[model samples]
Target: MKKLFLLGILSLFLCVLVGNVALGEEEKISIAYIGASTDLPFWITLRNEARNQANELGVEFIDLTPPSMDAQAQKNSFDNAIQMGVSGIIVGAADSRAFDDSLDKASEVGIPVVAVDTGIDHPHIASLVQTDNLSSAKIAGQYILDHMTRPGKVLIIGGVLGHQTGDARKNGVTEVLEAAGVEVIFRAADWLPEKAYEVAQNELAANPDLTAVFAAWDPGAMSAKSVVAERGLTGKIIIVGFDGDPANLKAIKEGEILATIKQDNVKMGRDSISLLVDIINGKEVPKYIPIDGFIIDQSNVDEFLQ
Candidate 1:
């Protein structure tokens, strides 16, 4: 009986030693990318960059962006990521406050979340990696002030309602234009080019002498440019856009768009992944990570094109 008891004790000690060794070995972690609609160019680029970064870091990446920017759909994807037991989550929310409950649940489960491009007001968000959109728009508004000699009417086209990015950009433009004594006409396009075109057409009909236009997104800028061209007011109306998409940059080169604010979405994606990895590895990270944006216009358009 004494011999048997000693053998049992020895076996237990070996089991504990093995368990410690296993714990010391690096374990592969999986991260979920909960992006906005993949159809949107900005979100697509962001997602691709995050995926590439995850691959470089040797972490499993799962994409969960919905086909459209629906709040419920994004919530559902978040729930799925939680169920899959991902180590971290990177999100570009469709709506600012739509993912509060889901994010709270992630926190409860100890899954760290990093917001990219769009952010929520949840306490659990580990970091926000995005451009300073408001400041960029303010720069665009300043461009309008410098160019539009006359303080006449100007139109402001925006994306969907309640979209944090759109609202911030619009607020920035409004602040500068209103201060410069420019009459501004505002409209929300819901991120639809057709709606933006229609609104631009109607606004132009009512205010034919409009001096300039501030489009809060690239698509809206394209639509506004089309309207200006159709009305034979291309050179007369200065159209500025947010989101320096390639097409918008082309437009800028062609003089259709006077200028656009370039959001570093790719950097935002890579940074979000890097921060999430740090959080998962028990490293400290800031609550907010700001990425700078630049104004791309005729003077600097060639440099961007190259």
Candidate 2:
């Protein structure tokens, strides 16, 4: 009878020990991604890559992108993710300064925040993963200066006026073209294709002899290409773009656009997750990670397909 009682107690003790071990095991990390605009292919591709990387790493991924490019909406999403106790956050900021308070709150609560594509001016950002937009924009500017046939009017379709990425690109292009004595007509399309198309259509009709057009973002470039094609100025007016969207790749193949700078968006997404993981693991990470960009033109556009 004593032996039976001892055996039962031993079994109960072993079960408790096993349960404690199971409870002590590390839980899967949860990552929250606050994308700027889901409507943009660039952000969509970035989100997809980040989600894939999170899945590969056995982490839970949450997408918190706003319906549109609304800054306040983005901040609300960040706050919600923080409230949900996310392990980390990868954000493509809609506005550089709008998320400062939410980022600060995340930092205070020990949830690391990494910025991707666009960056904020706040010190709370754990790391920034993006391309050097200014330098890449200069590439397009130099191409226009070297290849433009004449000194006729040149138009620039830029992103949001005060946005960091757009401002950097516009400044870079403006500097290079102004130094080359080219007349630049700058317009902000807010990164909207329809608005870009409207601007391009009106300008193409008015300026007829516009020498070149630089669309600082991929979708804007796509819209500009449509206007140029409709006006029968496909090969005549040099059209350069920024992001390497798949449609832009197709446009390059069809000779609709002259060239575009390809930002490593997949790397941007993957790196953001990697850095956040490192941070979560109590490892040091670089504050800034700059990915390289490629200039895609007809000569090498075939290799970029697929």
Candidate 3:
């Protein structure tokens, strides 16, 4: 009887040890990621990549995007993540200042916040993972200058006015074009395809002789391309944009877009999560982590497309 009792006790102890090990292995660290909009393929790809990376690391990633690029919707998402007690947050803020309060609340609750693609101006942000927008824009601008002999009027299809990425790209192009003595005709688009199309139509209507069009993003550029084709001005106007989406690559192949800047979005997602993980694990993180971008033109579109 005594021997049997001892065996039972030993078995219970072993079971407890095994259970603890299993629990440790199954321990999930929850992370929240919010983007401007999920409708854009670029953001979709970025979120998927981030989720895949989180899964590999035994982390739970919750991705949220507003129905549109609505600031209040993004703030609500941030608030929801905070209420759910997420370990960390990675946000591509719709507006830099819109999330300041929510970010502060997250910080108060001891949740580290990392910004990806777009940045929050608040100091409480743990880190920022984004491309060097200005440098990428400069590459596109140089390509345009080289492709067009001497400087004629070029249309600048600007993105959402206040968004950091859009503003940076516009400023970068403006700087480069001015330096190269190119006349820039400005037009505004809300970063929506429809809005971009309208802007493109208006620009073409005003400046039919425009030599080139520089769009802040790929979708906007593609929208502009469609309008250019509709107006029967395809070969006459060169189109350059940021973000080397696969569709953009196809456009380049078909001789629609001249060039695009390919951001390391996958790397951006991976690095942002890694940085947040480090902070959660009590490691110090840098305030800014800038990732560079590459220019994809006809000569190198094949490389990115493959």
Give per-residue CA lDDT, model 3, range 1-306, as digits (tens).
Answer: 999999999999999999998887556578998987888777877888888888888888898778577778999999999999988998987777688789789978899899999877887788999999888888888888889853478888886678788888888888898898888877778677888899888878887668899988889999999998998878778999888899999999889888898998888878888888888878998998888888888898888785
Give the residue spans of candidate 2 off by over 4 A. Answer: 1-25
Q: By lDDT, is 2 or 3 better?
A: 2
lDDT of candidate 2 over 1-306, digit per residue (tens): 999999999999999999888755435588999998988888888999999998888778999898788889999999999999989998897778788778789989999999998878888888999999888888889988988987798899998888899988898888899998888899999887899999999999889779999998988998998888887778999999998988999998998888999999999989999899999989999999987776999999988899
lDDT rank order: 2, 1, 3
In model 2, residue pairs whose N, Cα or C atoms come closer than 3 Å (at least 3 residues apart or on different chains), thus clashing, are none
Report clash pairs, candidate 3: none
Off by over 4 Å in 1: 1-26
TM-score per model over all chains: 0.90, 0.91, 0.91
Please give me the total number of clashing residue pairs in predicted model 3. Answer: 0
